[model samples]
Target: MNLHLHGDAIPEGLSRRARSFVASHGVRADATPLEPYRERWLALGVPGEVIDRAVAYQERWGGLVLPPAPVYECGPRYLYADVPEPSHGGGWWFVGGEPRASVAFSFMIGPNGEFGLWGDTWAPLHASVEGWVESLALTHHASQWAKQVTRLHGDEVEGLSLDDFEPVEEVQGIVDTWWRGSDSLVALHNGEAECFSGRVRRVALVYSGLDKWGLHGQ
Candidate 1:
């Protein structure tokens, strides 16, 4: 299957606000020049080569910067290159920008077939995508996990940390193996979405807090 992927390599700690904003407002593909992302990239003093490469990558695949929206929380945003998917529980929204991987092209998949995430720098975000996807899958695999989480905490939402959980490699392996059979996956977020047409699925949102996620789409 053919796929196209588009995302931002945003700096840490600055993604939540962006994500919240979009979730509150909505996702727009035709939104002109993405100033927030561009400015952030420029501030990071990212190498021209990397910028050129990323821009070229987007151009080749029709990737676009996420449109500004009301703040949902704070952090990087991952707007799909296509429209949001309606199958999965609500839709998938991004709290952090796509994760980066050292490898140019690494394929990661989630069991639900919701969407894929990737990154440019692997070492740091190496398992980021796998972590996010696997974490989400954990709830699906063992509904007990979610039930326990909810029942244990009740509506109080106390002590829920994304960092506290670990990704199950075995489950990720199954998802990855399954993804190989398909050509591409459709990604959705904040009432908007995009399609990734490539072999690389490496983007991820660093889950610093549980509130970073919401049931808006669900």
Candidate 2:
């Protein structure tokens, strides 16, 4: 997986608010060393290759911006005790994103180098840190676009299916990112829809509601 280090570059097609958020808090080109965080991952027994890739990602991008939320952070035991285990066997280590918000999105890295998004429930997002970064950048943009649509067409959007809006095609090829169905649309549920490229089918309905935004894996 090729890493797309978005050092201070606001992804194209984000709203003014989203663009401003990215410009203000996007990853820094001159990021601090992540060596200090290695011990934390090592303590959790994260695989060496996963540690290396994750650390290298942070070093290059400084941190990720999933806006409306703060940059992703890494540390020991960042996962809340409440977070359930993934169905697979690997030990889960917290990657980043706000974990305490009413609608939170937290990332977890598995021992086998798998990455998952914990929002309402755990869903495998990417296979590696590089893939995760690319998917996340696209997710952030999609999220901002959703917010813009909500503000502009709130009432009209109620009960409206995602098919009404054009399918977002820019995020293709970011591994583990696109929804499985070819005709998937961002269906409005409770006033929001998690319209991104690679969202899984099971969690698609749950993600449509904005209320589920920060309810990480609950």
Candidate 3:
């Protein structure tokens, strides 16, 4: 897996949009380290590996919102993780977003570091916090590199063919998905849709006619 350079918490694999997001919208002050929450998390029996990931995530992208849309033309689209709360039904813990789902005002993270909702849906959007950041960055930059961008909604999203495309390991999809091909890329935004409304359950982006650099998402 690709990582950020020395001293920079943001991953180098992430897109310029993701960087700008932290720059423009992130809180000016650095949030307190997750080390303080270590004991509490351990008390919940959260795996040591998962706790390490969360602490690392806090240092890297904790306060910054994880936008659902690739091209973010709006604010407060997704909620970033915050302090953990035991006030949850399942084994999941409240990490970010709210119960209402308007934004990251309240959301939950699974024992394995999956970013998700815990209410009626109880679904994870990304396999892990790292996956969410990588996927968001991919969507923002990949769209600009493509020759064409296609948006799919409703049943149409499931109709598309991804013959040669493979799952982008950077994003381990749970409710959402990302696929890559020789000349194209696909991003599904069911995470946001499911949290907002469980009705349609279809939101995909197809970036085709990509150049060599676009294919790799430089």
Candidate 4:
């Protein structure tokens, strides 16, 4: 995944609010040091590159604060929820997420620089934090588009495409993934309603939360 970095290596394609948050609060080199957190990550056996990338992100965005509401409250605090070692084992380090969601999912990274969605199950996602950032941008765009499409079509949001919205090169992969897989776009509609009913019940992409992937409804 190619992450577009703006000045100071801040990944582009983040929501406007997210970008602004970074602009205002992201720590610079001269800001508060993050060595303590780095030490903690190191103690947890997180890889050096991953730790560097994460710390660089903290310095750039002032520590992983996500958008408000449904979005998970992630940051250094959540990333380090477990110290020494993650409770889940498998050399996975707990990252962050909302545990109360219908499908509880959390972010995790393996010692080999593999990042993934970890719940009661695990789903590999990106190869690195950088890739994860790119995926996050795509997920954010897809979720927003899904919301708008749902509003516009009401009960008929199936087969929605980015063409319906402004063209975004970055989201092309997500769109492709959605179109190619039945499990990609999971919707909640009245079971009684006709399948493919044009009614816009509720539409959600697999990677909506940046933590949850595929179906959690089981």
In terms of TM-score, the best-performing candidate is: 3
Candidate 1 worst ten-residue window by lDDT: 185-194
Off by over 4 Å in 1: 1-45, 56-77, 80-126, 144-147, 150-167, 170-218
Task: Please provide, for model 1 over 1-218, each residue's C-alpha lDDT reduced to its tens digit, 9 standing for 90 to 100.
Answer: 21222134222222343334223333334322232355566566544444443443333222223332111122124322221112243322221233232323222222233233333311112223333333333223233112222222112222323333433232233222111101111111211111233222223222111221321112
Candidate 4 clashing pairs?
26-62, 154-200, 155-198, 155-199, 155-200, 156-198, 156-199, 156-200
Taking all chains together, the TM-score of candidate 3 against the true structure is: 0.67
Candidate 2 lDDT: 0.38
Tell me the whole-model lDDT of each prediction, alpha carbons only. Answer: 0.27, 0.38, 0.62, 0.39
Q: After superposition, how far is residue 102 of candidate 2 from its true place, in Å?
A: 5.5
By lDDT rank, best first, the candidates go 3, 4, 2, 1
Residue-pair clashes per prediction, in order, are 46, 11, 8, 8
Candidate 4: C-alpha lDDT: 0.39
RMSD of each: 17.4, 11.2, 5.8, 11.5
Cα misplacement distance, residue 90 of candidate 3 (Å)? 4.1
TM-score of 2: 0.40
Error of 4 at 148 (Å): 5.6
* Stretch of 10 with least lDDT, candidate 2: 74-83
lDDT string, candidate 4, 1-218, tens digits = 22333465555645453454444443333234355677777776776655564454444433343333222222122122232234354443535322334434555554544445554454444444444443344444446533232222233445545442332222122212232122233322221122223221434333233222321221
